[model samples]
Every structure is written in C-alpha cells, then in structure tokens.
Target chain A: MVSKRMRVAANVKRGPYATLTLQGEVIPSHPGQFYMLRGEWGISPLLGRPISILGEDLARSEIRFLVKAVGEGSRLLHALKPGETVQATGPLGNHFPLSGWDPQSPVVLVGGGVGVPPMAYLARRLSENGAGVIFCQGARTKEDLLLLDEIQETGVTPHIATDDGSAGEKGLVTGLLERELEYQPGAVFACGPEAMLRAVARLCRGKVPCYVSLEAAMGCGYGVCLSCVTRVKEAGKVVNQRVCKEGPVFEAEALPWL
Target chain B: MAVNLAVKVGTLLLKNPVMLASGCCGYALEMGEFFDLSLLGGYCLKGLCAGGSEGNPPPRLCETPGGLINSIGLQNIGIEEFLREKAPKLRRVNSVMVANFYGHSVEEYAAAAEKLQAEPCIAALEMNISCPNVKTGGIAFGTDPKLVHEVTAACRKATRKPLWVKLTPNVTDITETARAAEAGGADALSCINTYPAMAIDVEKRAFKINTRSGGLSGPAIKPLAVRAVHLVSKAVKIPVVGIGGISTWADAVEFMLAGAAAVQVGTALFSNPNAPLEILKGMEEYCIRHGFKDVADLVGAARDFERPDCNLPSAVIVTGEKVRK
Candidate 1:
C-alpha cells in the first residue's frame, strides 16, 4: 500500500461527528476496507488511527471518512479543514466479500456508533449489485447517529435505535435486528462496539451467514505489525488472525466471541 | 561530488547505513508494494524460531507517548517454511538479507542457525537473544552476560556466515553483554533491542497488552539506544549496528556519531513504509551539506569528545618558553 499526502477537500462537522473528504488520486477500495490516517500533528500520538471507508466517488476521485472525536487523534481530525494535507496509507486489509450471494436474497447491514459508515457504503454496493438491502444503526441518542441521510440516499430505509429513545426504537440495535431477522435475511454484515457485534453474532449464528468488521488498536495497518489480531477458530483450533491482513471483515462463526 | 553511504559490518558491506530492523519488516516482500526493497542497505527478516509460532493472543500492540509497545512474541513461519517459500524470492532482491533468529535454548539457536547456513541469500545471522532460555528458569538469555556468550558461541559454531548478536537493553550493564558477544567470536554486534516495558488500562484495571509486558520501541527509546551504542561500541572492537526508535536520518546520524557503524529502522516503518529510503536520502543530503566525502566518517565521531582524565587542564597555552604550568 502507498502512503499519500492528500489535501482535504472538506471537513464538515455536526455535533460530535465529522466527515473528511480527501482529494487525491483515487486509491481503489471496497466496502469494509480501511485506511490508516494521521493528521499533521507531530509524534505525540505516534501511530496512525484506522478509519473505515465511508464511501468513494470514483468519477470525482474523492474518498471520505466518518470520524468521531473520541480521542486525541480523532479530535485532531475533527479540527482539520479544507486545503490541509493529511497522510493516509491504505486501502489496507481484506474487504467484505460481496460476490457469491443470490441477488434475489436480502442482505442485512448493521452498524453502531461510528461503525455506521462502512455499513452504509456496503448497503449501497449490495443494492447496486442487485441484492435487497436493510440497514440497521444504533447510537446513544438522535444526535449521535452517523450518516443516516447518506444511508437512506442508498435507497434503503435505515432502522435506527438509540439508548435514550430519541430515535426510531427505544432500545439496542439488536432489538431491531431481532425483528428484521423475522424476514429471514440471506446474510448479515455488522460492525460496531464488541458488545453489539457479539449480540449480532449470537442472533445470526447458524441461521444465516454473518460477517462482522472488527476494530483494534493498530500499528502498521498492514500485516507486518501483528498488532490488530483477533482470535478465531480454524480447523477446530483457535488461532490469532491479523485484523489488517486476514480481515477487518470475518465470518461471524469463525470468531471465538465467547 | 557523490556522497558515499556505504558502511561495513565485518565482511558484510551495505550500500547505506539504513536497514530494516528485525520484527518490523516482514520477510521484505510485504513492503515491496510501498517502495523498492533494494533501496535499503539491508533487510533483516522477522525473528525466526525452530517452529512456527502463532504469537500472543489479541491486543498484541498498544501506543504510548512518542512510541509503541508490541508483544507479538516473535511470530514467524518455521525455518523450514522460510527456506522453502521465502528464501528463494528474497534471494532475487538486491539488498543484503540478514536472518534474525531466536530460540528458547542454546541448542535450539544452534540448530536453527545450522539449517540456515546453506542458504546463500542470507548474508549474515542476527541472533536475537531476548528470548527466555527454557532450561534456565525462564530468565531471559539477554539479561545475563554468560548466557549471551553461550548463545553467541553456540550459534557462532553453527554458521560460517558472519554472526551478529542483537543485545537487549533490558540489562543492568549493556557493555558487559557487548563484550561477552565479542569474546564469543561474534563478527559484529547490534546494540539496544527494545526496552522491556508495560502499560495498563485504567478503565479496566488491567494490562493493555495480552502478554502484560512487551518491547517498547519508537522515538522514545532513541536516547537510551544512543547511550547503549555509545557504551557498547567503546567496550568492543567489532562494528556495532544501532537499532531502537530510529525514525529519521537525524536519528540515524545520532547513532552513527555515538559510534554505530550502521543503523536499523524499526517502528518507524509502521508509521511510514518509506522510512528507510527517506532516511537514506536525508543522510546523503546531510553528508553533502557537511562537506563529508564519506558517510563512514560520522561513525564514532563523538568518541573524540570523551573526557578520560578529570585532572587534565581544559586548555594549555604555549608562548615560546612561557607555556602554562
């Protein structure tokens, strides 16, 4: 992967959320793949933070990222503005496998908090590929939900859940998931906090094929660092798989969530 | 005038002083997509053991101020797999290849080295002595001078290739281990591997890394590495290869000025895959600006500033028969 210094086309912030659109030569990316982003801030933070691809405009050659200002790095990213340059190395890691599915079957995409971006992108891709799509998102409150309009623009109505009952459902995103599974989706794709992913895995286990994107503190965002590893069962034995290399997307059954 | 960046460590000569440190660059092939691997002075593959390792559990890495901590446990494909799969491809690269090997015992280190002796692509053997000796009550082989000598001597006998022993900075006195490796007939020495360190998660009241403690590397360790290289280079006659938190050409120059014949780029590779090449370019620019004909002239340049005698006058005046007393 190449590290490029791209100019920020725009940095739009709303509430606790921000979206950065980078203007540079398009680095071909697929849904669920991520880039390691670092602001011009010096070495205090050290490593680049991994951000998932929100969407790509191939014609415009613009790549966007949805970031939440939860820490120093994200806060630095939040403060970024137009014309500022940022270092990004990507499109690293394995992506969500979109092929081999029956186009007639519905595919469910679930996300929580900042994890909603990639799912939104996946929703659009799945819909374009002729698969029926459903998007489920969860957040702490109404203002915390990310990319709702963008997700809906993909032509899929987003089922949202908020902790404070300020949004669609007054419960966890899994509550909406339970109701959606009644339709018997052909597959499920999810990304979010560990608790929500575990819940999604439990709900979809053995019933429908499920893929979940995981987040870990990453160093290289490549195979070499071995920093972003997750435990998974392979051939009846548990082994460590690199989240950046083997997956940020993995078959839910393959993971040892318990 | 062209700047000469070539540096020699024993019989092995490098096009430049910048190399990819062990454990940071995987087999050299993974990084080829980012930059040309041949641009580096050398490439030290990840630490290899007798058998393939799955490494530690999840959360193998975490970041600290100006640095990062990694507990990968030296995950690597077994020696046989490396030879069967990776060595042939690595041989085609123009850079010098140094295999960094570690083991839980002296015999295991020797056996692994013996297996690699026939591989023509491997220009040298870098013995990573940080692993704990299973037969020695779990004390790390690098912490004791005797164990360092034993491991070095055992591997020295197993391979005809130049042997470069990598010493850990977790020791009480780094010079002792440097001396021990030289006495063991080592051709060269790599000083200051990662410092043993740990971090905790306050929210969970637990360790951030799965293995609890790991090696700390990055800009934070550069000063400590320079000190180690300064002391160790003075204690031994063999060329010293400096490693530990070298991110830029200035950092590499500091190591050379402190007495390192060459330097290795480690954690910085994660931040920028082009670090080694960037450092090499900066080194060339630095040599040209300073009017130095050769980069080797920077090695051990600080040694002249050492004050060995406290009683010596700072300055002596001589004015024909009126010299200051």
Candidate 2:
C-alpha cells in the first residue's frame, strides 16, 4: 500500500525523460532507497518508473528523482501535472551507512551521467557529518549534465566530464578524478557506468577505500528476486550481490568489477 | 502481505526458487539484511576464478527493451578469499546456497569446483561454460560440444556435490552441449545463460556493455529459454533448469510446460523481489486449479507429440507467417 498524501514538486526534462520531484512526508529513506510512483498498478500500464533516491529533504518532507525517459512509463511521468496526486510505494532498497565514515577524511565522489544525482545527496550527507567532499560526474555531452544548480548550491567543488569537450574535461569522468588524486583524497564514493566504476575501483585499489553504487534495472527493489545482482569481492570469491536489496552502494574496491 | 516462497533445487532444496542468477546477484551474502534468506528458493553467488579478474573496461551493462546486456568478464575476487569469508555464513543460510563457478580454462574450473566443494554450506554448483576463456583464446568452451564435455568432466571430478552445467544459447544445438554435460556426469543442467547480444547507446556512440559485447537476459530472452529448455529436456536424463526473462508465475508455468523441472528467475527478480513468492503461489494454484495433486504434473504439460513428430512447431512462422497447425 502507498500513502495518498504525495504532492508533485517539479516536472522537467533533460534527455529521453522528465525528472519528477515529489513532496511527501519522510517515510524514512536511506541514500539508495527508491520510491515507485505511477498509476494505481504494479508494472503494467507501465506507470511512472522507479528512480534512484537522489536526495531527501527529511525536514521538508520531499524527495527527488533523476529519471531518464527510456520508455513509456517514464514518458508518461512527464505529463504529471504539478499539484496533481500520485500513488508512490517506498523509501525502498538499501542505503549507504554513514555509521563509521571518518568525517575528517577527504571524500572523493565519482559519478557518471545521471549517477551524479545520488552522489550529490551523499556529499550533502557526508558534509553534514563533517567529511570534506570532492565530487566528479560525467556525461556523453554537456547537455546530459543533470542538476547542476542543486549541486552548485551544495558548495562542494565539482569536477565535470563529458565524452566531448562540450563542458569540463574532454575525456571521461575517470580522467578528471585521476588528475585530482594528486591531491590525495582519503576515501572515494562512486556511482555510474560499471566500466568507469571498474576503472575507479582499480585506481582506488591501494590508494583509498572506495564505495560505489551500482545501477541495476530493478523490479521489486526488495531482496527476494535476484535480478539486480552486482559482483563483489568477498575474501576470495567474486560474489554476485543484489543492487536493490543489498546495495545500490558498495565499497568500490571491494566489488568485483571487470 | 509478504508471502513465504521457497523451493528445492534437486537435493539441495531452497526456501523458494527465486534465486539470483550468476550475473544478477553479485556475492551470495550482499542482500542478507534486506530480505530473509530463508524465504528464497536459493541464490547462486557470483562467478569465480583462481586469479583476480579485472574484467573488461568501460560500458559494462546496457539496457534493452525487455532486458539488459552485460559483459563484466566474470570479474571475480579469486576463489581463495571467497572460501575464507563467504563459506562460514553461507553454510548457515536458512535456504540452499549455490556457488556459480566460471573459469578461463578447464583447470581453473577444476580448481574452483574442488575448492568450493569443500564448503559444507554450499548446496550445489552451477557451471557457466559459455563464458569467454579470458586467459586463453577468449572463447566459450560451450560453443563446442567437445569443450563442454571436457569442462563438465573436469568440474565433476573436482566436486562430489550436485553440479549443474549452465549452457549457452549461442551454440547451434543447445541439446548437444547438454548431452555433453550428461555424459560428463553433471547432476543437472540450467539452460540457457544469456544469449550473445549487444546494444549501442546511440547518443554516446558506445556499446551498452563496456566489453562492446555482453550476454542478454530478460523478458526478451524468455522465448529463447523456452526453446532451449524443451530441446535439452527431451535429450537429457537429468533435471533441466529453465531461465531467461521469468517475471511472472504464468511465465514460470510456461517453462514448466516446456519441460523445465524448475525455473530460475533472472531479470524478473531485478524488477521485483516479491516475484518469486508470487510465482510459487501461482504454481500451487495452477496445480490445484488443474486438478493435479502435486506440482510435478505441470512439467512438460504442453508437449504435443502429435505435432509432426517430436520437434516443436514454430509458435509463429516467420517465412510464411502462419502457424504450422
């Protein structure tokens, strides 16, 4: 069952989809927990799709989603009128634990394309905990860049990357962070393309502890179905882990990224 | 309501049959806290190797209309550490635990199986033979029946537990590889692993998976799984496991009717955790609704020997564009 008190915050677009913001009382979501907003149905009617929990203004009772319109479900979300009602399910999935994170550590934040959305929230959370955050994100082009205003508002310096020289560095997001590593960050938090994350995982191999958020197209966003498994390094075995229930977030170097 | 869903895979029974396929669930234990492991059919841990796999670079996964493509190159933590940390808690799992093993060579498979066999908690082992032998010529041992035979034999000798050889749909004859596994004394068979496929992010001008190629699984791959399961079931003596894009109980029933002894939900589980529970309930209801006392009656129920011999007629003819019947 879902709460009916949800309110629309914003309906905007970037690429194939429109980003939707919802204002609802905090159902209590961790960094990676997601909310399913759509017509009154499960997956059918292809209703509004699930989006990564970008950030939560727990005090204000609002949450944000960086959605890409890859299909009919997402496309329909663009038509959601502000102030209109929606049926949303969760605050679901696992969240990154800030429990033992050392606040004084120089946290290197790495994200790619829309993956940058969650990292922004992570930076805000880490900053609140007293950690210094350095953010990095990449897109195929400058137009693909998302939420620059909200990010800039956080006051954490951001390093940008695009496939072309449309904005920031010309290469990939990995390049921007590699050069910045000279300054020596103590920890790294990343989410984005696995290839890029794998590269970052290798770079963080011996340098710092890396925590990465993997993206798996999820269905239940719970633990039962084994659909969203990502491989992780557990002692000697590269174990397949579920991104939905286990983590959208994990130790970067700890995951078995090829 | 949270449904209680669990099933057994051969002798190694599970709480439910909704397991984490090889590439879907990373490590066996990553999601332990999110759900009650006791409720799952059983989950196969990530693939493994003797050495650390850096895997291929960049675009690792790409999304298709109904599924996704991934070429993570069987990136593993090397078998040694997995035993030290994962084995202990895994053995204590409320449900069955299966370790999915992969290797770049026959010896690697042998070593991984032998080592994993020693773990008491591991209920069974799944062999993904179609994976590219990264250390060798970068090809799958399953593409040829001979390699599949050799690989299965080596792995069989290395373990005493129930072993399931996962077959690839890339081969001309999936049954040929399945027979090879049977000849090699494999306890069972899981067909098919994702088919060889690729997707391009048109905007980025890049392949969907970082490897420029990857295995495809999801609803789109469901039809292929049904075909493979039918062929292998008819050819082999051991139980046949069906997998593809199983997202619904109705889909599971279809696989069972096509001769899958049990079905493994891959891409469907990614979409919904409660899917397996729903499927289990559906199977039971189907048994009751069909007036069958046990669920086994559903296996291969759709087989029609009258269809111009044993070969299944094309559900939809592409050439003439008509059903054969």
Candidate 3:
C-alpha cells in the first residue's frame, strides 16, 4: 500500500512497445497482479495509470512493466530513460491461481497483444513447478506478437495466431484455443480484449474450469474509489465487484459474459 | 506542553481536527494495512442506506485539471450488513467513528439513522444531503432550505446521537441551507460536498463518466469550499465541519481560520493513504511555531478581520484601575 519513487534500471523499446525495469525493494507479486504508475507529469492526468506486472526478478530486486504507447500516461512511461524515477503503488489486485493447480495436468494459457506479458511470467512459473504449459498468443500480424523469443526461451513454444495470416494460424486466437481444448487442459487462464475473453469463456464454458483477467479504466487502483467494477453473478443476483480488489482474475463461470 | 489538537462537534470529541472524508477511505479496514487508524482524529465511513445498492455502472470516474468527477451512486452493503461486517472491525479502531447515512426519502434517512443509533462504536451520524449520483432525495433535499429542514428534523427524532447535516455546494447561497439545518435542531454541519460536474471524451463523442455527470472533488474546489464554510459558519450558530479537496495541512488551517471546527480529507486519500495523519502532524507543528497552546484558537480567526472598520473599537469599558478599550 506504499507509494515509492523507484528509479528505472532499463527502458528498452521493441518496435511499438517498451519494457520498463524498476529498481526498488523486491515486491512479492504473482501473475495477473498490477501496479499503478505515474510519471513526474503535473495534475493534467490526476490519477496514476494501472499497469500489469510483466515480470519480476527478486534476486535483482527489480520489477518489469510491459507498456504500449496507447495514451498520455503510457506514452510518458515509454519515453522514460535509465535514471528517471516513477511513482508506483502496488502489487495490487488478485493474482492467477497457480498453487492449487495439479502438476500432472496440462495448463492452457490464452493472451493477446499487451495481455501476453503476464502469460510469459505464468508460463515460466508453471513450467518450473513441473507442470506442462501451452500458450496461445494472438496479434494483428507477425510484428504485433510480443515476447515470442522470450517465451520460447522458457522451453515452451507458443501457439501463435495472426489475423492477417502472416504468422502461425490465420484466424482468431480462439481457433487455436479450440484445438488446445481437445487435449482437455486441467485449467484455462486468459487475458485480452473483452471480446476475446468472452469468446474464450464460451469455448471453455462447461468443458474445463477457466479464469479470465478483466480490465477497466480506474481512478484509484485500489478498493476505495469504486471506479473499476465488473458485474458478477452471486446467488442468482448480479452484483458489482471491485475489479481492483476482489479480482483482476475471476472464474469464467462466475462472470455473466454473453 | 503538547498542543491540544482536540475539538468538539456537538457531543462527539475528536482527538484532532483532521478526519478522513466519506467515500474516499472506505471502512478504514482497507487502509489499516498502510497506517494506524488511531493517528487520525476521526473518519466518516461511506454513506449507507436501508437496503443494499449496486451503485452506478462502470466508467464511474474521470479526471479534470486538478480534480476528479465520480458518479459512484452510493453503492453500499446496506445497514444490516455494515453492522455485521464493518462495525465490529471499526469498533476496535481508537478514533471517533461517524456513520454517514443517505436515502431516497426523509423517512428512509430516519430509518437508517435509527438502525445505527444503537451501535456503540458509532459516535455520531452525518446525514448526506449532497450526493449527486442518486436520482432522488439526495441533492433535492440539500438545495431547498425547507427540504433541508424537513430531512434534518425527521432524522433528529430518529437518533439520540449528535446529528451533523452535510450540505451541497450546488446552490445559490449555502447560508440559507445552513440556517435551515440549524433551525431543524441539527447539532453541527459539514459544508461543501462535491460540486455536480461532468467531463466528456470529444474524440469518442461520449461522456467520460457513465452516469453522464458526477461530483467534482480535489484542489480545484478548495477555494469554493473555504468560501462556503466561511459563509455557513457565519450564518449558523452550530459548529461547521469543512470538507472539500483538503490535501495539505495548510489547506486544513485555511478552513479552521475561515471558521471550521474540523476538516475532512477526501480525494487526496486516493493518492496518499496517510494524508490525514500528515495533516495532523503539520497542524501540531503549526500551533507550536505560532505559540498557540490549543488548535481551537485558530477557528474563526479570520471571520471579521477582513472588514475595513473591524479593528475600530465600538465601545470602551472602564475598569477600576485601568480603562480597557
């Protein structure tokens, strides 16, 4: 819950995206967890921008964030230099359920565009734990795919799909997801645009248990503001759950995605 | 000697003049992980109603130059659930706890107050008449002087605990409403809730907030809030609790000088969870440096000093040994 001004160890740009490695005390975070980051910019953009945890190296006491120059905040983040500092408050929100997972069964992961980074962290963690991992990555073209070599270095080759047919499969990522479901994965985890998450929820509906990470424009990346909420069904009644607190990760069946 | 930071609002006594504003601090338990709640003078809990409310739809907030507009619709777990879940945890915190209640009608406000009246942990009740998100009974009761009196009078009968009526800033003259609340037997007043405002995404051709409009809070509203507190405190005889965009200790001092007995921190908690405690420390330093033994000496210090002829003595009293003018 503390907001610290951490120096940037590295800001590496790869095509349209960038990765920022922050130097600070090690923050214990799991996959799908996020942090709210803001630059020294003035109050024009009053609140901090919510960024997912791409990876962390506790040995170096550094955390990495994979950012795309989508808006004012992200654009500022991408332009950060090596010595510049940024304010960060985190390890906020829920994380992916990896502890309860059975090691003998295969785990399927679905991610798209900016959503692909956490999957890389999840894949490496699951693989180190002696569980089989399969990753399905989606993008607009070959150049749009993120962290392929990094993910492949983890000893798992990703099943990639490109919409323009310039890469592995020539359709939506869900097309490859259907093929992966045939092997009967023990659990399915996904993070992406809402449409893709809905499709994945539909594909994994009754066949296997699934968890999806949701995104919302947040004022405070904590429980106080009540800004980031998703409608969830509990006991036949739909209630708005704070996405920053109760979840950024939720069971697919618990969500009313139609 | 240590500075006496304590202040009284009706029957409730605060350890200091800094309190966490409602809707920004949640139930206090969520923030307990960051700092000790006992460091604060008090904290006003989120607004509650007779029944559970789901609040407004998502895209509930947007940022302005120096503030935020939010239409959260007062989403809460109802009084029964709050009593069962949050009150027990709040009871353990060593600070004054004020329950903020709101409803769609006067009767509903009374009913909610009655439910919280028996809770030993709750030191007082604040009736929220300034919530801009609800469709009825919120800003409606706060705008008109008669409606303000009606709602306060109804709740006055419901609870024996001290009642503090929170006023809306979206009015022609806030003094009218302040006087009305005092006439209705309110023990204290909390002036200047968020102003009704909106933001739009011109590129997308849509409102930035889901509810089309929301309440504005932060540094942008501080000057306006100080003016409201000054006017309302002058118009009413009851104590005034100033709130609206108080982020720093200097801001809290400005409110006290303008006649607020205490001040509340709202949107600043989103950025810094320890704002109330920070303000409290700064206030103590300010009192010691100014050679004041008590923080209450600063309240209403600027009320009549601004007048051109205020320094002139109207009457001269002659004592036995010396003439004191």
Which candidate leads the pack in TM-score? 1
Instruction: Rank candidates, DockQ, best first.
Output: 1, 3, 2
A106-212: candidate 1 lDDT, tens digit per residue: 88889998788999889888878878888999999888888888988889999889999998989999999999889888889999999999999999988888999
Task: Determine which window of 10 residues in candidate 3 chain A has minimal summed lDDT.
Answer: A38-47
Sort every candidate by lDDT, greatest first: 3, 1, 2
**Candidate 1, DockQ score (0 to 1):** 0.79
lDDT of 1: 0.86
DockQ-based CAPRI category assigned to the predicted complex of candidate 1 = medium
Worst 10 residues of 2 chain A by lDDT: A39-48
Where's the lowest-lDDT run of ten residues in candidate 3 chain B? B315-324
**Segments in model 1 whose C-alpha atoms lie over 4 Å from true places:** B131-139, B303-325
TM-score of each prediction:
0.94, 0.67, 0.92
Give Cα distance to truth, residue B175, candidate 3, Å: 0.6
Candidate 1 per-residue lDDT, tens place, B1-325, comes to 7999999989999998999998888888988889888888998998887777777776778888999888887778879899999998888799889999877778988998999898999999998886321223123788889988888899889999999988888777888888898998899998877887899989999998888888889999899999889888878899999998899899999999989999999899887887888899999999999998999999988633437766665554231112335
lDDT of 3 by residue, B1-325 (tens): 5899999877778989999888998877877777888988898988988877889987899889889999999988888999998898888899988899898888899999899998999988989999998998689899999999999999999999999999999999888899999999899999879999999999999999889999999988999999899888878789999998898899999999989999999988876666777888998999999898999999988733335766765544221112335
After superposition, which runs of candidate 3 have C-alpha atoms over 4 Å from their true positions? A99-102, B303-325
Fnat per candidate, as a fraction, reads 0.77, 0.09, 0.62
Q: Per-residue lDDT for A214-243 in model 3, tens only?
A: 888887788988889888888898889989
Greater lDDT among 1 and 2 belongs to 1
Best by DockQ: 1
Model 2 per-residue lDDT tens digits across residues B1-325: 2333333456765554456666565575645644566766777777777765656544455556766676667666777878886677776677767788877688888888898887888789988776642435224687788888898899999999999988888877777888888999898898778777877778878665556667777888888788888878888889888888887888888988888777777665444444566677787776666776645567777843365666775565332123566
